[model samples]
Target: MAPERYEADSDPTDLSLKILVAGGFGVGKTTLVGSVSEIRPLRTEEQLSELGESVDDTGGVDRKTTTTVAMDFGRITIRSGLSLYLFGTPGQDRFWFLWDELSQGALGAVVLADTRRLEDSFPAVDFFEHRRIPFVVAVNCFPGARGYGAGDVSRALDLDQGTPVVLCDARDRDSGKEVLIRLVEYAGRMHTARLLDTVGRP
Candidate 1:
């Protein structure tokens, strides 16, 4: 038996891509980033004590104290020499300014949606849409959560026909990675389409 030639074969599509994980408050942005990230995820969490109780909502996420103040960062090596830098953005309106800095030079974004509070994702959807950045919506399936079909979410978010929406569980590494891959595929298609358009093709 000959030695396996795995080392000789390298992935042709090995390019580094930066993707932003964005959503509203209490969404699973951190969970999703941590799930697929190969490295120890770097997170900035602030203990939300009684001080924030008067301001922050205490309905679905009442038990949560610590909140992601800045961002959660992680890395995932998709293929040999190809990796992705995942930035889990803070969802609160106070941190909205950070979005511009975090999203600079990024390929696109993955907007995490929680069906229970679908409206919470409005800001994230709007932010990307306003910037004309290519993005995909990933419904994070929390435990015991009701299933909302992609179509319903698309209608709720008022996304365009070209946008891709899919279900995912931020707690599951494979599922989370699949969501990231879907966004990557969408970005690739958009890039190709733009190139074709630039060449005078309809």
Candidate 2:
């Protein structure tokens, strides 16, 4: 299916969007949302327990104690009358059912990647790709994590040629904001192209 189009004459205020922050377990989805949001982020994180430990893999992120069980909600104003409502998805497999609900009316998505566990983010990339949703991969640079160039990470992920792969520090507001900006710009371009195609149709 073709990607969704944004009306060329739509109001800027009406352009407020729902953007998903999807990634694998301990990939910093929650951190990214909270870092860049202008409003206080709402999180549904719960302390990990023995029951969860049995199913949740904390191999690289063993330092992490909490998990987002449902989702993280936040808001950011990109510019005058243009805003984004971010919905950071729960990374564990059990909470994946919530993704269907969170993704409704979404404009685009950002799939965060952790180099320490590169394979963990594959599900997010695949989901957006299959859905034809505009998305960008933001590699969250953690301390002591192996360094990978954007091209190397892109190749490792088997990403489509045009997909944007950028480095980010999810814990930093500026870094996280840049990731969103990149995604918004990419999605905006795709939307504009779709609208143009529609206009040019005979």
Candidate 3:
């Protein structure tokens, strides 16, 4: 069973953490945010049209009717002093112009991966890696999707050592929230390690 929902945190928070939700098209980026957000998520999905037939590859996601055009925005309060702002980037290359602006203050990111179309997530992972952003790979387990172990995914993606890969159902509220929590914790660890490295260097 999913964890119980937390009450709304009306008190101003001591920290506002920004997290980017990035993944390939039709990989459930919006679903993850909508499932866990305390507030109604703002989505800019438009019906898939002929304009994308020549560009957007919908091989595994043919059933998807809509695609995010710009970005998805959502909010969740982790506690009294910490809140999270989720910004989901558009998957298609045409809308990638918005990513820089959305990623400006992100603490980390969650890159949703659909097992059936795993390769599609590579770009997102590369983007974060190239930018030195802390992120986790959350496999979005769709029905009938093949089960792949975390290590297998890590190997396939060529993720750096110590990076985390987790299995999740984007539709589940608790599972989605757990993904965000894992990102926060991982980022904390990385930050601490970097601090230690700096201290030890001198």
Candidate 4:
């Protein structure tokens, strides 16, 4: 069966969109989902243990003691009738298999980035790019971390020309909402462009 299509001007009275929150370990994907979700978010976090120390890279996030082993689930109503279902993908490579399942019907994705460990976000960027999935990079402004402008991050990440890069505090509801809003807008534009291209074809 064909997948459902999400349009920019679709009926908002009863629209529900699926959005994935993905990024490197400790980049705050879980925090972003929890902050924006109107309902209590579901988490699958496990305490960091000695056995996994060698596999989990806690370089920049040394203070983080727990890791998300599965996905985080949440729901947010953007308006009276428009709601978003958020799925936060586990950041570790071992759990990557779950990503395909979580992203099956997603409208788009938010990739959280930490300036202190920017390189860790590379895999997520590559994943979305290779899948032709519309995604926005939300830089989680961690305290004491060097602040990088959106342009600088876009350049450093080598993002596609029109991909968006926004600064946000994942722990704040307003900031997290803004990131999701940006992703929705960007995804809408991308969908429209693709439709126009298809129509223009022979």
User: For candidate 3, lDDT tens digit of each residue in 1-24?
Assistant: 111122334654366778989999
Instruction: Give the alpha carbon lDDT tens digit for every residue of 68-165 in model 1.
Output: 88999998877677678888999877788999988886788999998988999988998888887789999988766678899999999999897999
Residue pairs of candidate 4 with colliding backbone atoms: none
In model 4, the runs with Cα more than 4 Å from the true position are 1-13
Off by over 4 Å in 2: 1-14, 198-202
What does candidate 4 score in Cα RMSD to the true structure?
Answer: 3.2
Decide which is better by TM-score, 3 or 4: 4
What's the CA error at residue 185 for candidate 2, in Å?
0.6
Q: Give the TM-scores of the predictions, in the order they appear.
A: 0.89, 0.91, 0.89, 0.92
Q: Of 2 and 3, which scores higher on TM-score?
A: 2
| Number of the top lDDT candidate | 4
Range of the 10 consecutive residues with the lowest summed lDDT in candidate 2: 1-10
lDDT of 4: 0.89
Give the per-residue lDDT digits (tens) of candidate 4, residues 8-84: 34564477888999999999999999999988999999999999989988888958999999899998877776778
- What tens digits encode model 2's per-residue C-alpha lDDT throughout 1-202? 3323333245633557779999999999999999999989999999998887789898889589999999999988787667788999999998889988888777789999999999998988999888778899999999889999999999999999889998999999989888888999998887777778988955
Query: 2 or 4, which is superior by lDDT?
Result: 4
